[model samples]
Target: MVKQVRAARTRQALVRAAAEVFAADGYAMASLPSISRRAGVSAGALHFHFASKDFLAREVEDAAADLVQKMAGEARSSSGTVLESLVGTTCRLLVAMAADPVVRAGFRLGSDPSRKNGPGVLAWWRTWVHERVAEAREAGELADDVSPEGAAAAIAAATVGFEVLGGADRDWLCEERAAQFWAFVLPRLAAFPQQAMATVTGAGGVR
Candidate 1:
């Protein structure tokens, strides 16, 4: 029992360490030795848990994807308009990126040119944004001139930009920064700017 508990702990530590390294150095540049050392585990231990860096990277990406799915699910289930849900989810995501290295690494890994694998977390986020925008359009929540695809694309691009910029400067992910973005975009994107702004304001822009 003790051995099992220790092994689980060791694996968790390795995953966290690898996420930190990948978040800082991209997947190709991140070395196993460095990850093992960061986890305070021997090389043998890391190899026992993950045969190669590819497998470890996949693990991190999967974990990150799961987190995003949960966030999206929460937004869908919440008692809010599609537009309000979209704003709330986006703010929460940026806040997560700022505070959680694992989430940050997941996004970086998805965009890293070094990885041959397709974008994982990023693609999921884009899809979520597109779906939400489409739903908003159907509900008459978006401005008449706003194209669902265009709005989704712009929102995805902006959120990804925040994640990339936040890696170097956390201020980009702060509540004030998120509020500024929502305040500007909501006024332009929503069918009723005042109510949309009220929804975002009530949410308090990221905790």
Candidate 2:
């Protein structure tokens, strides 16, 4: 039991360390030795858990996707219009990414096309967004002209772009940018009725 716990801790530490390295240096420039050093683990120990950098990158991507899924679940459970839920979820995710080194690195690494390619983390997010948009449209919250697939692609692109921009420049105004995005998107999402707008403003105001 103790060995298992230690192994888990070690693996977690490695992932955390790798994420920081990747976030700072990007996937192409980050190295296993640097990650091992940051984690205070030997290269051999890191290899024991992750055979190669690609494996480590995949693990990071999985961890990020898990985080995104959790946030999406939370948003779905909260009370609000589909658009509000999406915006709230996006805010939560952005906040989490800002605080989590692993998540930041995962986003950075996953955004790079030169990295791993099996269905990728961003693709999963896009699919999730597409499904949510379709659900909202069916519920009569979205405009008749709204295309789920197109909206999903746009949202995904905007989100990734925001994150990349925020990460690159410390002085970038993240909250301002997010608010601008919401301002522009909310009206388009509320093409149906006042009730839909109320859903976003009432009890579940993207807390």
Candidate 2 structure, TM-score to reference? 0.88
Per-candidate RMSD, Å: 1.7, 2.8
lDDT against the true structure, per candidate, is 0.88, 0.76
Cα lDDT over the full model 1: 0.88
- lDDT, candidate 1, 1-207, per-residue tens: 999999999998999999999999999899999999999999999999999999999899998898888987886687479987887788778888887778889999999998988898999999999998999999999999998889999999999999889888888986667778888888889999998888655435732
Candidate 1: pairs in clash? none
Off by over 4 Å in 1: 202-207
Where model 2 places Cα greater than 4 Å from the true spot, the runs are 170-176, 192-205
Best by TM-score: 1
lDDT of 2 at 12: 96
